[model samples]
Target: MTKRTNYSKEFKEYVTKLVVLDGRRIVDISEELDIPYDTLQKWVASYKTKQKEAEDNRQNALLSASEYKDLYEDERRRKLELEEEVAILKKAMHIFTLEKN
Candidate 1:
């Protein structure tokens, strides 16, 4: 009976990074790391998936921030218009009162 090997997270992550980020070829990585080719390939694939997800999250955050800025500008303009209208109404009321007296 063969015992199963227990690998640590740091070791796996290091192996995956060597293959994916370091631009080392899979065949070379497998040979150098003494890991199976298919296993290394799977790790590289998962690493790519994680990188893509992170990029998508960053893009979404930038878009949301831009949208919030646009909405804030619109609200500011609306507030300024309302303030001007109120000032006009107050002036009209003052003039009306003086004319009546």
Candidate 2:
């Protein structure tokens, strides 16, 4: 029986990136990296899947950030409007008290 080989994380990542992102074919990458074709294909598939998941997460983060910003701006506008209303009511009360005197 032959021995099974285990690759390191950095090496596997490098192989995956070269083949999946850089458009290198599995057979070519396997020849260049001296890895098995089946293993290289598996790495490429996994890398593509992970890359898509990462992009989706980034988009979600951006959307959440924009939503928070909009909510904050709305709260600020509401506070400013309430302040103006309170000032107007105070002025009206002062004028009524003067007229009553």
Counted clashes in each candidate structure = 0, 0
lDDT of 1 by residue, 1-101 (tens): 84456668888889889877788899998898678788788888988899999999998777477798999999999999999999999999998889553
Model 2 per-residue lDDT tens digits across residues 1-101? 85689999999999888877688788988888788888888888888899999999998777577798999999999999999999999999998889553
- Candidate achieving the largest lDDT: 2
Off by over 4 Å in 2: 64-69, 72-101
Candidate 1 residue pairs in backbone clash: none
lDDT accuracy of residue 20 in candidate 2? 71
How do all models score by TM-score?
0.62, 0.65
